[model samples]
Target: QGTLKYSFNAKDKSAEKTYQCEVDRPDPTDFSINCVGERTKLAIDIDRNLGKSKVYIDLNRFAGERFGFEAVRDPQTKQLD
Candidate 1:
């Protein structure tokens, strides 16, 4: 796990939030992705054939200047297509 640290301030109020980010160790069994440039598409092929699962893209995960990502999924399958 890693620590996420940041600070915030306002004219009349100030706040700080510190959270823990658990590093995701790659698991080839279920989830996989195809990435090109700044975009990433995730596909999960589960054993149960659950049709297709959808994943939401969080912009904050690619907050740094050196990297970025956006989610593109099919409307029918709701999986990255």
Candidate 2:
């Protein structure tokens, strides 16, 4: 359980948002995480692709955040670029 308190807009009105997240096994073979919040939820899963070696992320449907793509992981070094 996690609690986050902040103002939603410039009105300075206080608000409290709570969330709960649980992770069972997050290893090389399998990874899963479940998160729930006031009006949003996120489910992340990482698994090997048997047919293709590709990795993708949810941008429109599942993910509602529009965080700019100014930062990315270097494909070769696996570091933040």
Candidate 3:
């Protein structure tokens, strides 16, 4: 298992807040990934040469008020995986 720590600053009309969270990496087949953010968004990366491999993210149901993903990568090389 792998863990990732993220932090971001978010502001609305009234105020601003800094948020942080630690999220565990999801399974390779589980393309539906999410980030906890006030204004949430999804980020997916895929290696076309790696067969049908792809990444999917859905950030509509996050817990935190602000969040983001730094990066996501498989343990093996791009060619191997």
Candidate 4:
């Protein structure tokens, strides 16, 4: 138990996702931090949250440059293809 670290749980859900970290008998001097990251969500959220922060985007490049988009389904065929 000298240098053992563990993650207690994780969640993959429809609305949100989360994680947890746990350590056994942590030392008084030991400090820890946990962070959550996402790929597509981060890419999209960056532009959205930045906009809410009173930033300007007069260049009109946030659609593909900042927040990339994907096609979940084809409108014509209604399939993943």
Candidate 5:
């Protein structure tokens, strides 16, 4: 478990908020984390072998978006990027 915090401005006023968080790792190669509070939510998925990853965030009061990434290791050099 953890905490998620953020600050934002609306109409020239700044405010900060915090959320309770939880993380889960069902396997050694893959895992996920989630944080939620009020009307906001944040989630993430990761692969240990440099395969794929995803992230999503929503703050209810604003726009939300999701991102995806994929990576492969070089067989000869054993490097990932």
Candidate 6:
């Protein structure tokens, strides 16, 4: 468990916030981490066996956009796509 700090600036305004984070490894090949704040949340997952990873973010009222990323590796070719 840990804490994450973030700062943002827009035009003439600036803000700072802190988030609490947790990490877990439920399986030998899998790992997960999550962080949450007053109005934001973030999550990440990784699977070593399958060579897959993902990330998710939500910035409730702080930003107008929410985004995520997903990636997979081709086992035979050893290439990520």
> lDDT per residue, candidate 3, 1-81, as tens digits?
222344443344345532233334355544433334354444444433333433334445664443433343454663443
TM-score of 3: 0.23
Q: Which digits, one per residue and each the tens of the lDDT, describe model 2 over residues 1-81? A: 343343456464556554476665655655555566666654555443221122223344455553222334455666654
Better of 4 and 5 by TM-score: 5
Count of backbone collisions within predicted model 4: 0
Which runs of model 2 end up more than 4 angstroms from their true locations?
1-18, 49-81
Order the numbered candidates by TM-score, best leading: 6, 5, 2, 1, 3, 4
Say which candidate scores most in TM-score: 6
Runs off by more than 4 Å, candidate 6: 8-16, 62-65
| RMSD value for candidate 5 | 5.0
Off by over 4 Å in 4: 1-13, 19-26, 39-81
What lDDT score is found at residue 28 in candidate 6?
A: 92
TM-score of each model, paired residue for residue: 0.28, 0.37, 0.23, 0.18, 0.55, 0.69
| Candidate models: Cα lDDT each | 0.40, 0.48, 0.40, 0.29, 0.73, 0.88
What tens-digit string does per-residue lDDT give for candidate 5 at 1-81?
988777676444347677789989988988988888777787788876666667777766676544445566554676766
Of models 3 and 6, which has the larger lDDT? 6
lDDT of 4 by residue, 1-81 (tens): 122222334353454543232332244433333222232112111122112111111213334443333334454655643
Model number with the top lDDT: 6
Q: By summed lDDT, which 10 consecutive residues of candidate 6 come out lowest?
A: 7-16
The pairs that clash in candidate 2 are none
- The root-mean-square deviation over C-alpha atoms between each candidate and the true structure, in angstroms, is 13.6, 7.5, 9.4, 18.0, 5.0, 4.3
TM-score of 5: 0.55
Kindly state the number of residue pairs that clash in model 6: 0
